[model samples]
Target: MTRMLLSVERDAIATAARRVMARCDELARMSSSTEGIERVYLSPEHARVNRLAAEWMREAGMSTRQDAAGNQIGRLEGAFGPEAPALMMGSHLDTVPDAGRFDGIVGVLMALEVVRMLRVPTADGSFRSPFPFALEVIAFSDEEGTRFGKALLGSSAVAGTWDAEWWNLTDEEGNTLREAFREFGLDPGRVGEAARRPEELVGYLEAHIEQGPQLDERGESLAVVSSIASARRFQLIVEGEARHAGGTPYDRRRDALLGASEAALAVERICSAEHHMVGTVGQLEAYPGAVNIVPGEAHLSLDLRGEFDGTRDAVWQLLTTEIDAIMGRRGLRWKAREIHAAPAVFCAPLLQDVVRAGILSTLPEGVDDPATIFSRAGHDGMAIGAITDVGMLFLRNPDGISHHPDESVSSGDVARGIQALAEAVLQLNADR
Candidate 1:
C-alpha cells in the first residue's frame, strides 16, 4: 500500500506541540515529590492525571472512560460504528522516582493531537472519522511499577495476561495491591473486564522520547523502533566468614564484599564484549554495621539486557562463569535468584514501513530515509505485544539522560513528531 500525505497544517502542529509541552509542565507540578516528578500507580496523582487527560480527550472530540484497571481511554468511532476494530495509540502516564517530565507523558499527548487532526468536523456540531477502523488513545495508569515492583500492571490487564498472584504483592509500606485497587475506587474482581480481545484492535503505535543518545549522537531528530530489549533481573548474594577487622590479617580474611565487588566488575567486562548487550549492578549492600567489623555477606542487584533473547542468555551464562571463578578464588559462596525475564519484541514490518514514511514526511528535501534503532528500554508494548502488534517512534533526548530532572526534547522536535505521527495514521488508513 502507498503512503498518504498529511493534511495537517504547520500552524496546527506548532500549536499542538506547544499545548503538549504546556500540559507536561502542568503534570510535572502534580508530583508527590517536592524535588522532582514521581507519580505512581493507584495514587492520588494517578487519579488527577487521568481526570485531566479525560478533559483533553473530550476537547479533541472523543468519548472517554476509565477502564476497570484504571487506564484512561478515549475513543472516536469510525463509520462502521462502535464495534469496529480500532487503531490504538498511546503510552503510560506513570513515572519512576525523580523522573523527567517528558518520558511517557509526551506520547499520550501526541496521540491526542493526532486524533484531533484526523477527526472530520461536521456542520451539525458533531465529528466523523474518514477511516473504517475506530481510533483510540490510551493513558495507561501504570508502567514504571514503582509502587508494587511489578511493571506493566495496567497493560497486562488489557492484554489478558494479568497474574492472579499480583494481587498479593505489597509496597514498601506493607500495603497490598488488592488494597491499593480498592483505595483507588476500583473493584479488584472486575479487573478481568479490562481485557481487550485481539480482534478488536488493528494494531498499536506509540511515540516516545528515545531515553538514549542514539539520535542525538547521529544528529537526527527521530527514529523508527526496530525492537524492544530482552531483559533479566537477578538478586545475587555472596557469603563468607565474619571476623574481627582489627585482628584478622589481609591474608586470612575472607571478605564477601570484595568477592561481590569483583563479580560486579566481571559483569561489566563480560557484557561490554558482546554486541548490543549491557549489564548494570545498580544496588549493592554489605552486612555488618561498624567500620571496624568485617562483612560476612553481600547482596547486589543485576539487570542484564540485549537485543535478542539467545544472545542475552548467552551473556548471562558467560557472566555466571566469570563470577564463579571470582568467588571461588575469594573463598566465598554465592547464589543468584532470578526475579524477572522478558524476551525481545520485534516490530511488525508493515508498521515499521508506515512509521518510516511518517518520519520521512517531516524531513527536508532529499532526505528520504529515517534511522532505525532498537530500544534498550522496556515499554508497555512488551506486555501489550502479547495480544496485538506494536510499533514505536523515538524522538531524540539530549545527552541520552532519562529518569532524571535533566532529560529534555526540543519543541521543534515535538512539532515534527506530531506531524509524523499524524502522517502515520493516514498512511495506515491508506494501507487498509
Candidate 2:
C-alpha cells in the first residue's frame, strides 16, 4: 500500500484558527462576568456557541450531532470500514469568566482542521476515501465547572462517570441542572447514552495551549505531555466571634480572618519546602466583611497540586494538621471539607512517542528538543483517560498565563501545533 502524505494547507489552517478565535471572542463577550468569560453550562449563550460549532462542522463536511449531554461531535467515516475504532480528538469549550481567546477553543478548532485535511475523494468520484478509522471531533461542554461545581461534566458523562444525582443540583440562583438541560433542549435522563463503548474508541488526543510557561521558557513551539498533576481542593472554615473592630481587645478577640491568613501562609511555606508540591488558597470569604467589624467567620478554599499522588496527599495532610494546630492555639472552631480530588495521570507511552515523532518531523530544523513536562492543571483528557488510552500536545504560552483575559499563544506556535497534531493523527490512523 502506498503511504499517503498527510498534510494540511497552511493558509487553510490559519483561516480555521482565526475563525475559532473569532468565535471565542464572541462567546467571551456574551454573559461577560467580572471573574472571566462566563459561558455557564447549558446557558442560552452556550447553546448558541454549540450550534454555531455544529454548523461549522457540517460545513467542513463531517457528520455532526449533539449528544444528550450537549456535547457537539463531528464524525468523519473511515475507508477501513465501521469495524475499526475511531480517533477521537477534542477539549472543552466552556471557559472561566473573562477568559482569553485560545484556551479551550484551540483544541476544538484544531480537531476540525484535522478532519478537513483528512477528507479525501471517494472511489465513486464523490467524497475522498476516508482514513483507516473514523475521526471524531468533539467540543465538550461544561469543563470549567464554573456553574455546576463539576469539571469535565460533558466528558465525564460520555465516559459514563457522571453521577445521575448531579441532575438535581441547583445553582446559587436555584436553577436546577435538569432545568438547564431542558432549557438547552436536551434530556437529562438520556445522558448516559452518550458514552462510547470501548470498542468504538481506538485512542484519544487533545491539543491545547500550554496555559503555563514551560514551552515559552524552553523556546519551543510544542510540548508532549507526560503527566497531569494530582490535585485536591479543600474548603476550610474557621469560626470566631464578631465584634467592633475598635472595641474588641486584642487579647479577647478570636479573629477568624487572622487565623485563616496564618493557615494560608503555612500552606505556602509547607508547599515551598516540598519539591514539586504547590498549594494555593485561591478563594476566600469572610463573614460580615465590613471595615468597622471584626470578621466572625473565614471560609477559604485551598488548591493543592503535585506530580505524585503520595506527595500531594502528604502535603494536604500536613496542611490540615497545621490548620488544626492553629485553630487550637487561636481557640477558634474550624471545619474542613474536601471538595474535589483528581489523581495524577501519565500519558500512554506509545502515544507520546508517536506525538514526539510527529512534532520532530513537522517542525523547523534545529527545533529538535521539545520539552517533556507534566501538567499541573487538569483537562478533559484526564477524565477520558479513565476509560481509554489518551495523549495530549501543549503549545507554547508566551507568559504562562491562563484563565485570564491576557492569556495568549503566538501564531507561530499555533501553526506548529497544527502540523504536529495532523502528523500524529495520520501516524495513529495508519497504525491499524
TM-score against truth, every candidate = 0.98, 0.93
The worst-scoring run of ten residues by lDDT in candidate 1 lies at 1-10
How many Å off is the CA of 302 in candidate 1? 0.6
lDDT of 2 at 346: 87
Worst 10 residues of 2 by lDDT: 1-10
Question: In candidate 2, what are the lDDT values of residues 261-283, reduced to their tens digit?
Answer: 99999999999999888899998
Model 1, runs deviating above 4 Å: 1-8
Q: Write model 1 residue lDDT over 1-432, tens digit each, in one string.
A: 223333438888899899999999999998989988999999999999999999999999999999999999999989899989999899999999999999999999999999988898768887757689989999999999999999989999999999999999999999999999999999999999999999999999999999899999999999999999999999999999889999999988889999999999999988999999989999999997468878899999999999999999999999899888998888889999998999999988888988988898888658858899999999999988998889999999999999999999988999989888988888888886
Residue pairs of candidate 1 with colliding backbone atoms: none
Model 2 lDDT on a 0 to 1 scale: 0.82
lDDT per model vs. reference: 0.92, 0.82
Clashes per candidate, residues 3 or more apart or on different chains: 0, 11
